[model samples]
Target: MPFDQPLPREVKVTDSASLFRLEERACDLSLNSRLDPAWVRANAALDGAHYLWPALWNSLAHRPEVPRQLRCELLITLRAGDRVVSWLDVLPADFNPLPRVTSREEGMQVSQLLDRAPSVREWLLREGGGSGQQ
Candidate 1:
């Protein structure tokens, strides 16, 4: 669907995790919406085999001014399969470290988390998985 296409509802942003709520107010516009969960899961079977996957996504996300590719990948991965009983908690890239809170006022945990790139990457791997594609 086009980013301009309106959804049935919007998910409220009471918390960053709400980013994945997919309710009317919850989602941000995404250019790579074509890369949906079903597609990713279907293609994950070809992850490493796709010679230009990351580069292709980077071009779309960075060069073309689309949504962040890594973020999109993470989001899609979170929604894939997930036939398990537990809910797939899609963490807003903004929140991190135990007991942390994110908000415009009085919340400064963000800077520290950003500074620790390794931890962030590890989190991505742990959550998104080392080879998540489909």
Candidate 2:
């Protein structure tokens, strides 16, 4: 999906290999979105066990051209088999990813974080987000 497109709410993967692919896709998307690749390489890390992997991109917040309302963070959810494993946060420069949380409570926390951003909240309210396309 294009950067201008709406983000997906969740993504499903059957195994660790698929999860790794998802991480790569997320990183590629972030780079394509104009996030600094070098910064991403330096700051982005893979955490959690084989069932879950969350990736975050926070470079956009540093770009002045990006609007405040739209500067809301972005997250990509990762699932392994029948369970939700982790989430990726594509955040603004000013914000940091929330500490890793168990999959059970992640959905609610993601909602809370997105709600903190005006534009993101409106997008979620306007259109139910989905797991973004590869």
Candidate 3:
């Protein structure tokens, strides 16, 4: 589906976590919306990978210009049977870090998270994963 495709109803986001969970849930509702939580974990350029994944997702889901290659990888990973129960599960067991969006401001948190995602940066470079493709 295109980014412009509207769902039947909108998810109200009262907080960053809620917004994150809603987007994650949306990913499961359709293959067109699925994301590779593992790839987000490994490639996001954040100190606390666990929290930033959802924040980034919530932010990007609104935008129209997500890199085609990144979208393809997210969809491809789903077909490979990579299931993510929670963003928490994406982190290493020893990874104990505070939430990135403690202020409960979804927009600010989303901006900060996307600013730190290496894959987002790589996509911006237009090299498609800093190579021909990722």
Alpha-carbon local distance difference test for all models: 0.26, 0.34, 0.31
Q: After superposition on all CA atoms, what RMSD does each candidate show versus the true structure?
A: 13.7, 14.7, 13.2
Predicted candidate 1 versus true structure: per-residue lDDT over 1-134, tens digit per residue: 23443222211112223322321111243333232333234433222211001112222435454333322212222233221111122223322221323353423332332333233235446567443211
Write down the worst ten-residue block by lDDT for model 2. Answer: 76-85
Cα lDDT tens digits, model 3, 15-110, are 333323433544543324333434443433332222323212122455445321111111111122222122221111111232233444753544
The ten-residue window of minimal lDDT in model 3 covers: 69-78
Best by TM-score: 2
Question: For model 1, which pairs clash?
Answer: 9-24, 10-24, 10-25, 11-23, 11-24, 11-25, 11-26, 40-134, 41-134, 44-134
Off by over 4 Å in 3: 1-27, 31-34, 45-127, 130-134
What's the distance in Å from true for residue 67, model 2? 26
TM accuracy, model 3: 0.25
